[model samples]
Target: MNQLERLRKYTTVVVDSGDIECITRYKPQDATTNPTLILKSVLSKKYDFIVNNAVQYAKKMGGSISQKIQNASDMVSVGFGAEILKYIPGYISTEIDARLSFNTEQCIQKSIKLIDLYRIHGVDVSRVLIKLAATWECIQAAYQLNKLGILCNLTLLFSFAQARACAEANVFLISPFVGRIYDWYKKFCLDSSYDAVTDPGVLAVKKIFKYYKKHMYQTIIMGASFRRIEQILELSGCDRITISPDLLEQLKTQNFSFARKLDATKIVTVVDQPIPLSESEFRFLHNQDAMAVEKLSEGIRQFSCDQIKLEKFLLHTL
Candidate 1:
């Protein structure tokens, strides 16, 4: 079996792309789309229809320019997600606006709105995972949404505090960014070469996986933002892995053997103390971690920029 085929035996591979062709080719169990990906897809020829349709719908929407832009943005996001769902049998994650990352009420409202748009496109809410930044308020919002039978994907997760909060909230899934963590460490390292087994990003997810399994937290851990194939291979037995098409394709051609690195059935020897996830504690702990604080803020800012650029692109199509 190729790497992709072997990897699936240990993990549910998810295609992280906005292009339908990529999703169709890899046949990932699921697909994840973000503002940056959607923006890229909107510019492509094959998926431009989604953007054009959203623009037409927004022109008829009854709202101010700001509201129209917001509606169009949501439409484009769900539109891409809904289309991607047609190819994958599992859920498709549609991210909420990064600007709403810190606002609990707004995140909830936007999540509901995104689901409603999915409904308009004939997609069920259960098949959708509303992606939110892993803020304390956003975790609370996800907690509420999960209770209402609206599943969520707590994204942009970096620290142990964020992972613990998401697990405590019983979120549908949590996307711990693997590559972004590695990026920070590499930039700070005096020597360039880093071992995949010792990679900060890989170790971060391993820690979260062990914690979740030790306590038997039902939340799914889907490692995201992989920068290397070794990073993905290292987290082989994770609940799910959201990988880019480029990496997925790379894995498909390599004829190498891989083994599961994480096992839920293994003895839990790690410290399993329950971490405090109060609002103050979350902020304090997050602030203490230099990498988490810097990367979390940077991720939000970068996604917000892509979202604004997407809104502008849609405005032109209007």
Candidate 2:
């Protein structure tokens, strides 16, 4: 079997895009969409109707751009996700507003609103994993949401502390960013100063994976934001991998066995360790972790920016 087939035995492949057609080719187990992906899709000629519907939604509001913009955001997500849900048998992740990442209560409230919106159209809540940022507030929100029978995908994770916090809080899953870490090292390093053998992102995920394994945390690890096929291959045994369509297509063309690279059984840690993190401890852990802090902020900003672009598209179409 080829690498994709070989990797399938150990990992659940998830397509990371908004276009259902793009995802159908690889037959990923699940699919994920952020504001960026949806915004990009609406801009493309093939999905212009998404923009049209969102624009009509905005025009009906007939208010300030802010109000219409807010409506536009929701409409885009619901519109794209409604269509995107058809190709995958599993869940489709729909992210909440990134600007709400710091407000635990509002994040939960908005996520619930999103779920209710989806349900109004006969979409099953079980097939939707509300995506939230890995900020302390977002995780807390996910914790509460999970209690309310809502599953969440904690995203923008780049540190072991973030993973530990998410797992400790019993969040459903975490998306450890790989491409952004690679980008950071590539931009910072001189020639020959970097190696995928010791890539910082790889090390981050490995640390989190080992800790999760050692502690028997059930929170799934879905590696995201990969820059290359090698990084995906390196994370072969992760709980799930969300790959972009281009990378998924490339993997389909490759011929070779992709052996599992990270088996938790190979680790030598002898004792089961308990993480004693109260609110104070969780804050301390989150504060001390720079990657989680910085990247979480940056990711939210980028996603929020995409939301703005999507709103602009809605206005012009109106």
Candidate 3:
């Protein structure tokens, strides 16, 4: 069997894009889209209208770039999520701002607000996965949201501690970024590691998977941000892996052998403990994790900037 088919045995492959047409053709199990992906899609001739609508809506709102951008981001996200839902039966992940992650209250409020907005627009809440940074606040928000019947996908995770905390909180899913971890390893060269199978990012996800499975943690682990086919091949047995549309197509066409890399049954197990985090504890813990703190902040800025440029491109160029 090809690597793609082999990988399917252990992982549910998800298409990481906002392009509904592409998702329809690729036929991934689920789909993931963020500001970056959405913005990239909106830039194309086929999807440029989303940006125009977002800009017009922002213009009607009349406020600072931050406020207008928030409005515009919502417009853009709703457009992609609603349309993408037409192609995938499983949940579509829509991200909340990484900037809001540090504040548990805001994260909780924004999550509810976004879900409410979806319901108001007649979108099925069951088909949506609200994506958030894997910061303590975001996870805390997810814990509450889960109890209230709203599922979430925790993103931007890098460390085992972050995974442990996320699983402990009973969050619905956690996305341990594979490519970013590989990027960090390449930059630092921890122990002079440079193997395809042992890529740092791949290793990070493996550790999280082992920890989650060993603990019998109910929280699902979805590996994201893959820079190479090697990374995806290495994470074959993860709960889920979100790949860009082009990569998914490449996987479908390119013939390669893939080995089963992760098995929940084979890993040594740990007692499952359900530990809920208080608001204060959540804040303090997130503050302690410097990697999560920096990445979340950086993701927000990058997304927001894309939002601005997206609007400008739509208004002027489109």
Candidate 4:
């Protein structure tokens, strides 16, 4: 079997792209999209129909310019998601605007709007995971949404505090960014050279995985933002893994023996007292992790920039 086949035996493979062709080729169990990916897809000539349909839909709604742009941007996202869902049997994660990360109420509202858009596309809400930045406010937003039976994927996650907080809030899933963590450590640490086993990003995900399993948290840990195939191999047996299309192609072509590196059944039992993290404690602990703090902020800014660009593209079509 190819590496992709072997890895699928241990982890639920999720394609991290908005490109329908890529999703169709890989046929991953689930798929995820962000502003950057959505923008990329919108620029492609192949997806022009989706973009045109979104513009026409926005025009028919007859809102203000800003509202029309927002509507079209959202339609583009949901349009891609709806198309991808036809190929994958599992969930399709549609991210809320990154700019709303700091506003709990806005995050909640945007999530509902995105969910409603998906419904209009004939998608069952059960198969949609509303993706949000893992800010404190967004996390709270997710907590409230979960109570309403809206599952969420808390993204841009870096610190264990973030992971614990999400689990505490009973979030459906958390995407710990593996490649971003590795990039930060490689640039700042004295010794940058490391094998896959010693990679900082790999270690971070492993720590979170062990902690969650040991504490018996039901929150799923899906490792994301991988830099290389080795990182994916190292994270085999994680609850789920979101891999880029290029990496997916690499795994599809490579024939290799794979092993399950993380096993919940094999976690050593220890006296681990679960301490619920209050908002203050969560903030402080997360603040102390410089890598997490920097990466989370950077990730949000990048996504926000991409979202603005996507909105501009939609505005041009309108």
Q: Which predicted model would earn the best lDDT? A: 4
1 versus 4: better TM-score goes to: 4
Tell me each candidate's TM-score: 0.96, 0.91, 0.86, 0.97
lDDT per residue, candidate 2, 143-200, as tens digits? 9999999999999887676788899899999999988877776676575255656777
Name the TM-score of candidate 4.
0.97
**Models sorted by TM-score, best on top:** 4, 1, 2, 3
- Which is superior by TM-score, 3 or 4? 4
Error of 4 at 63 (Å): 2.0
* TM value for model 3: 0.86
**Ten consecutive residues with minimal summed lDDT in candidate 1?**
267-276
C-alpha RMSD by candidate, in order: 1.7, 2.4, 3.3, 1.2
Ten residues in sequence with the least summed lDDT for candidate 3:
309-318
Per-residue lDDT tens digits for candidate 3, residues 175-227, read 88777766665775558556767787787788788777877888988989888
lDDT of 1 at 297: 93
Candidate 4 residue runs with Cα over 4 Å from true position:
268-273
Error of 4 at 154 (Å): 0.7
lDDT computed for candidate 2: 0.83
Check candidate 1 and list the clashing pairs: none
